[model samples]
Structure formats: structure tokens, C-alpha cells
Target: MSFVRPDIIRPPSEHASYYLPLTSGCSNNSCAFCAFSFTTLGIRDLDDVKREIDAMSLYAKSRMWMAGQPDIVYAILRQWDGKRVFLQDGDALVYPYPRLMEALQYLNAKFPALERIASYATPQDILRRSVQELRDLKKQKLGILYMGVESGDDDVLKKIRKNVSHDQMVEAAKKVKASGILLSVTVILGLGGVAGSEKHALETARILTEMDPDYAGALTLTLIPETELYREWESGRFEMITPFDSLRELKTMVEHSTFSNCFFSSMHASNYFSIRGSMPKDKGKILRQLQALLSRRDPNMLRPEFMRGL
Candidate 1:
């Protein structure tokens, strides 16, 4: 089958990056709350990836355009500063190891000046590769990996079909750190819903401390219409916590999770509020901010429901 190029859905931090598609969809797409759950994974051909790299190189070096190349390539190239490239789709790390390595090698050969390369990787994907393999990729400039650790509570994980256990995710983080790759993980607030909220927050804090990621982000749950979670909500099988309650979970996580110099934030658009700073140092300030907001319980102080996005 021909590879269908995916639309760019990337981390906010990668706004300046060149979107390089090695794979589309996600390897573990069964997460009930995720839009990717309805899609199948697609791996782009190594030759196709190299060709895009070639086109990127040509366009970066001179004002040139390739006739057969997709217009999106040049659209991104026009804005790209040649500093970073973010692999596209959900889990590009799930791209077959040898081919992924070759693609990175090709990218380096074409753009040695590129500073960093990044991708969203599932814990399962990291577990599949050896630390040495990840190290090799890091040497090729794969500097960061964004992982979604949704919830650490076992029940919540099973409910969401995250597949991997908290321990497995901790191991994955260890492997990524051991390989010297900067690990950035994200967890969802209110994933446990009303019934298991406290347990979810505490377990999430525990797991976050265990993983000790270089960066951690907290995102509020925003049910998409077609997702299983949304259906469950409609059927009264799932209960979402209030927005302030979501902030409470965020506060619990921030107050409890210990980090060896980590940047923690709730800056995603899905969040009702944003608080960010280096952990252990700014923990007090962040907590106070949430506390003051929680104390007032002002609806106007929070982001409106209509403004939230997946």
C-alpha cells in the first residue's frame, strides 16, 4: 500500500521543527481515549523518507522545488530553520529498527548541521529496542522522546487500554534515560474519573517519581466524540471529574512527585490552567497558584469548556 502522508500533530515544543513522517498512526492504538485508536499504523518506505530528506536538502541549500514531491514538504521547508526535525504521526520510534537507523543516517548525511531529532514513542516501543539501539539513535541526533504515560493507577490504565503497567512504563523511562535520551512524559488528569481520582493522582505521582523524567506535562482529559471513552460517558459507564477537580489532580501530582531537576507543567491547551517551572524548586509557587485558584473556585478564572481542544 502507498504511504498516506499524515497531517502534522506534534508537541507544542516542536512548532519550529520540520515534520518528517517515518510512520503514520500509532503502534499501540487501543487507548480508548485517543483518536488514533480508530486508525491503523502505517510505516513509510525508507526510500520515500530518504527522498523527502533529499528534497529538504535541495530546498534548504537553494531556492528549488521538486515537481513530484508533496507540497507539504516545501511548505515546512520554507519555515524550517534546519535546527530540528520531529518524526511525524504517533509513534515513529515503532518504525523498524534497521530502516529507522538508515533513515536517520540519511538525514544526518544530508543535514549534518541539524541540532536535534525527536519523536513520540510509546513505552512498548522503547521496550522493544535495546538501550544500545536507542543509544545508537541518540548518537545520530535523536535527542528527545515524548511518551504518554496516561495514568499510573492499574485500574485506570486497564480502563483506558494503555496495555503497559506502571512498572513497565518505569522500566521504559529507565531505558530511555540509560540510553542518554532525554525523556519527556505526559499524564492525563481526570483519567481515573470521580471514582478513582485520588488513587490515580497518588499512583501517577508515584510513577512520575519513579520514572524521574527530564520533563513531565499534565493534560486534562477532553473526550473526543468518536472515542470509546466518550461512548462510555454517554452510556453512563464513565464519569469525568469537574475542571477544578482536574486541577486538584494536577496539584496532587505536582506536590507529591519528586524529581531530580525536572521541568513540570500543565501548559497543554486541554488544561484549564497553566503552571510551569523546574520541579522541587518551584513546587511551592506552583502549588500556591493552584491553591489560590482552587480557593476562589471562580468559573471565570478557568479556561472555558469551549476553548479546550484535544
Candidate 2:
């Protein structure tokens, strides 16, 4: 199939980044809670990717528009400060290794001034490459990877169809660290629901401590309609945790996980509350905030249900 450009889903931190699509869906798309589960992965043609890079370079250099290029290209370039590039779709790192390298090489050659390039990567994708392979990409300015590790509890992982185990994710994080590329991972609070929330939170904290990622983010499970998890919720097969319960999970994770200078946050829109601080240093402060909220159990203090989003 001819690769279709995917939508502009990206990390919150990549607000200023230029979206570059190398793939259109995730390699591991069976995760029950994800919207990408409804889509199939598509690898863009390398020549097409290079053409977009060329257009971006042209626009950056002379504010010229390339014929046949989508207007979105120029639209993005208009505000782009020419620093960060974020690969798009569900998992752009799954793009064929050689082509991915070539694309980055071309990107760097065109915009040597780019500070960093980032992409969402699956554990399988990282495991498939050697440290040297990741190093090569880092040398080409692929500075960080965002990975979705929904839950670290093996039972929760299996139920969600994450496929990869806790050990595999930790291993992947290690490989990224070894390659000197920053690792950012996200885990979902309340993924195990009411019955298994405690174990889920504890195991997730264990995994986070083991991975020792440079950045860790906590996202609450916001069931998307038509998704398997949503259907399960509809049928009463899954129990959705309350806002306070979700905060409790977050607190447990924050109190338990140890990090070597990691930035941890629950700043995603899906979350009911946001607390960000350097783990270990800000651990006490973050905990006190969650504890205070838990103490009051004030619905008013939490983000309104209408405002929560995926």
C-alpha cells in the first residue's frame, strides 16, 4: 500500500517540533486500549520521505514552496524554528533500519542545525537493533525515544496485549541508555483497574526503578470508544477506577520508584491531576501534594470529567 501520512499525534513536549512521518501505525498494535489498534502499520517510501525533507530544507532556506507538496508542509515550516523534528504516527522507529538511517542522514545534511530528532519506539523495535545501531542514529541526531509501557504488572500487560514483558521494556531502556540516547517512557495509572490496581502500581514502580529512564510520565487510562478496552468497560468486564483511586495509584508509583535524576510527571490531558518534579529530589514534595488531595478527596480539586481527554 502507498503510505498515507498519519495524523499529528505527538508527545506534549514536542509542541514546537515539525512532524515527520516515516510510518503510519504501530508495529505492535494489539494493545487493547490504544486507538492505533484499529490501524495497520505502513512504511513510507524512502524517496517520498527524502522529498519532504528536501521541501523542508528549501522552505527553511528561502521560504519557497515546493510544487505538489502538501500545504501542511509549508504550514508546519512557517512556524518551525528549525530545531526539533518529531517522527509521527504510532511508532516511526519501526521504519526499516537502513531507510530510517538514510532519512536521518538526509535530514541532518539538510538541517545540520537541528538540535534533536525524536520518535516513539516500541520495545520490540529497540530490541531488534543493537546498541551500535541506535548509536548510529543518535549520531545522526536521533536524540530521544518515547515508549509506551502501559503497565508493568505481567497480568495487566497480558490483558492489555502489550506483548512485551516488564523485563523486555527494562532491557530496551537499558539499551537506549547504553547508546547514550535519552529514554522517555510512559506508564498508565489504573491500567489494572480496581481489582489489581495495587500490584499494577507497585510493579510499574519496580519497572520504572529498574529502567531508570531519563524521563518518566504517568498517564491515566482513558478508554477510547470502539476500542477493545472500551467495549470491555461497556460490558462490565473491566472496572474503571475513580479519580481519587487513580491519584492513589500515582502516589504509590511516585513514592516507590527510585530514579537517577529523572523528570517525572502526570501532565497528560488524560490525567485527572498533574504533578511534575525530579524524582528523588522532589519525591517528598510530589507525595505531599498527592497526599493532601487524597486527604481531602475533593472532587473539585480534580480535573472535571468533561475536561479529561485522551
Candidate 3:
């Protein structure tokens, strides 16, 4: 099948970067809570990827268009600032290592000014590579990797079908940091639902401290209609906590997680309330902020349900 370009879903920081697709869908697609579980992974041909880079180069140099390429390629290129490139689909690092290297080389050849290249990487994908292989990619300007840790509780991990264990994820984080790449991970608030909410938050905080990520984000669980998690909720097997409870989970995580200067945030659209701070430095202030919100228990201060997104 021909590669279908995925919609531009990226980290908020990648707003100025080009979206490059090395693969479509995720290699680890068994997660019960993920939308990628519904799609099959597709790896784009190396030559096809090179052609897109070539097209980008042509447009950067002469504002020319390339034939036989999807219009979205040019659309992203037009908005690109030439400073960063974010490889797309769910986990582009799962792309074949040699082919990925070649593609990055081709991209660098075409755009030498690019400061960084990033991708969503699954723990399984990172663990598949040797320390040196990851270092090589980092040398190619692949400076950052966004990993979805989801939850730290082993039971929660098992329930969500994350496949990778807590220890394995910690190993993956160690590998990324060893490779000198900035590792950013996200944990879902209230992922353990009502029965396991507190344990989920505490365990997640433990894992975050263990992972010691350069950046950590907290996302509130938003049930996607067709997903298995959503079905579980509909069938009453999964009981979601209230909005305030979600914030409480976030507060618990923020209060317990220790970091080596990590930038922690709950600023994702899926979050009930947004708070971000540099860990260990702004910890006191951030905790006080969460305490103030939880103390008042005001729904008016939280993000509206209709405004939230996955």
C-alpha cells in the first residue's frame, strides 16, 4: 500500500518545525488507550522519503513545487522555519535504523541549518537500538525523543496493554539520556480510574523520578469514543474520576516526583488544569498553585469539557 501521510499531530514546541513522515501508525499498537491501536504501521520507502526531502530543498532554494508529492508536504514546508524537523506518525523511530540514518543524512544535506530533529519513540523502539546507534542518530541532529510512559504502576500498565514494563521503560530512559538525547515523557493523570487513582499517581511519580526525564508532561485521560478504554467506561468496567480528582492526581504527581531540573507541565489540552514549572527549582511554587486550586475546588477555574481534546 502507498504511504498515507498522517495528520500533523506533534508536540506543542514543534509548531515551527516541518512534519516529516518516516512511518504511519505505531509499532507498539496494542495499547488499549491509544488511538494508534486502530491503525496498522506503515513504513515509507527510503527513496520516497528522500524524494520528499529533495522537494523540500527545492522549495527552500527556489520556491518550486515537486510533482507526484502530496500537497501537505509543501503545505508544511511553507510554514517551516528550517530550524527543526519533527518526524511524524506515532513512532517514527521504529523506522529501520539504517534507512532512518540515510533519511536524516539526506535531510541534513538538504537543510544544513536545521538545529534539531525529533520524533515520538516507543520504549520498545529505543530499546531495540544499541547505545552507540542512538548516539549516532543524536550526532545526526536527532536531539530529542518524546516517549509516552502513560503510567508507572505495573497493574495500570498491564490494564492499558502498554506491553513494556516499568523497569524496561526506565532502561529506555537511561539509554536515551546516555545517548545524549533529551528525553521527554508523559504520564496520564487518572489513568488508573477511580479504584486505582491514588496508586496510579504515586507510582507514576516514582517512575518519573526514576526516569529522570528532561521534560515530563501530565495529561488527563480523555476517552476516545471507539477505543477499548472508552468501551470499558461505557460498560462500567472503568470508572473515571471527576475533573477535580484528575487535578488531585496531577497534584500528587507534582508533589512526589523529584527531577534533575526537568520541565514538568500539565499544559496539554487534555488536562483539567494547566501548571508548568522547572522541577526542584519551582517545586514549592507549583505545589502551592495546585494546592490553591484543590483547596477551592472550583470547576470554573478548570478547562471546560467541551474544549478538551485527545
Candidate 4:
């Protein structure tokens, strides 16, 4: 069988020190606003994955040889240029626990000096893994987990068919955190539109504060073609929040938030103004900046539509 290698997938923030992809397709694969199917060009076999790892080893060794230096070799291997590995595709959690463990183990065996590993995981898949199993995986060097919490509004969650609930996300995040793995929860701004925007932001802020994840991300909504959300938008059944309105909602989210020690970011590509600050205390200043921007309504303060991608 032939496996198609995807050229690109959703990547973590540049601020994140390292990112890794462990699997291909998303396990849930039913979010209304998602475009994972469009992006997943192929599925890789287990053996194929091993071969990729082998190729990486050979590549690293060749680079090391070219340098003609033992001291710089470790740096070469550790550099993501040849060192950091991102398990590509949609989500890597689709791999069976044991098989996934085996692949991770093999990677470590090949590159004993690797820095960090990370992947995307749905709440359902993470919940399926026992806490002990997650902890063991952490011990094996899994560093970060990116979870798409989308929105904490239950109605919106049901509408998107996220296949998981707010409570489920909270519990799953707790488990991952308890396992000593860094948890980054994603929230989509403008998810609830102008109608539900306030409630959506408030609920999301409340949930994130409750979960108290290590990192929280906010992304403005951009409707991509072929997804259910796109259809709704095309039909005018869904009213998207304007950039200003979206920013207002983001401000609400920050204002309502109560996270004590969370690093919050809206530095995603789709966002109008990327904001990065710690929560609770910084929330006020962040909201103030956003509100001031909105009050000014300077065209230059907003990101152009062309720059925002789905």
C-alpha cells in the first residue's frame, strides 16, 4: 500500500519551544468548522513510520559526518532542523497505545538526545487513556498535548458536534495535567457569532479558569470551504462576528477569566491582533488594549481579510 505524506498540518505556536505530530487523522473527525479532511493527504503504515524514523537517523548521521565534528554533532541532532520531529497529519492519538509507545521508544533509541515530543489529541482519545498510561508516556518523554476545546458553550459544542462536552474536556485536561504533561487548550473566538458571543466567551473563560491549563489559545473564526460551518455561512444562516466584535468577545473572555498562572495567547494566524500575556492579572490590561483598539476603530489596527485564513 502507498502512503501519502501530507505537506502541512496545524502547527503549534512559534512561542512553543517544540512541537511534534504522532499520528495522521483526527479520531473524532466531526467538528463542523474543521478542515482536517482537506489537509490529511495520506495515511502512513506503522512500518512506514519506522522507515521515516530510520531516514531521519540517516539524515542526521550524514549531517554529523559533513560537519566533521563530534562536539557540534549533538547540537546538529538536537536542532529541529534535523532534530525536532513533528508527528504529522491531524492527530497522533489515533495510534494504539502500545504501538504508539513502541514508536516513541524506537525514536528515542535512535536519537537518545532528543529534546521534546508533542502531539494533538482529542478529549475523547485522551480520556480513553488511563492516567497511569498517560504518566508512563510522559516518563517516556512526551512533552506537550494540544487539545481543541473550541468553545465551552454547550449549545455551540452540540451544534459543532465536537463529540465531547465541556465537562469532558475539563476532566480530560485534569488527567493530562495530573500526568505531568503540559496541556494547551484551544478556544475559538467568534465561535458563537454575535448572538451567542458574550455567553460563549464567558463560558469559555469560566471553563479555562476552572481547568487551569498550562496554556490557553484563542483563535478567531474563519470559515473554510466544504465544512458544515462554511455551508451555514454561505446560506447566511450563520452570522460571523466582525473583527471588532470578535475582539470584543475576546475581551469578554479575558475579563471573565480567572486563571491564576496560565499563559494565554491569541497569536494564531487567523487572529486580528495577536495578544500574548499571562492570565488573571494581565487579563485586564489585555482587555483594555483590545477595547481601546476597538474604540479607535483604526483600519490599521485590524488584520486584513486576506491575511486571515481558515
Q: Which stretches of candidate 2 lie over 4 Å from their true place?
A: none
For residues 1-310, what per-residue lDDT tens digits would candidate 1 score against the true structure?
8999998999999999999999999999999999899878999999999988989998988879876898889889889899999998899999999999999999999999999999999999999999999999999999999999998898899999999999999999999999999999999999998999999999999999999999999999999898999999999999999999999999999988999989999999999998999988999999999999999999999988889878
Residue 139 lDDT (model 2): 98
Scored by Cα lDDT, where does model 2 land? 0.94
Backbone clash total, candidate 4: 5
Error of 3 at 37 (Å): 0.9
After best superposition, candidate 2 residue 82: deviation in angstroms?
0.1
Clashes per model (N, Cα, C within 3 A): 0, 0, 0, 5
Task: In candidate 3, list every pair of residues with a backbone clash.
Answer: none
Candidate 3 lDDT by residue in tens digits, 1-310 = 9888887888888889899999999998988888899989999989999998999999999999999888898888888888999999899999999999999998998888889999999999999999999999999999999999999999999999999999999999999999999999999988999999999999999999999999999998888889899999999999999999998898899888899879999999998888998989999998899899999998899999899988
| Order of candidate numbers by lDDT, starting with the best | 1, 2, 3, 4
Candidate 3 versus the native: TM-score?
0.99
Give the least accurate 10-residue stretch of model 1, judged by summed lDDT. Answer: 59-68
User: Which stretches of model 3 miss by more than 4 angstroms?
Assistant: none
Q: Indicate the TM-score of model 1.
A: 0.99
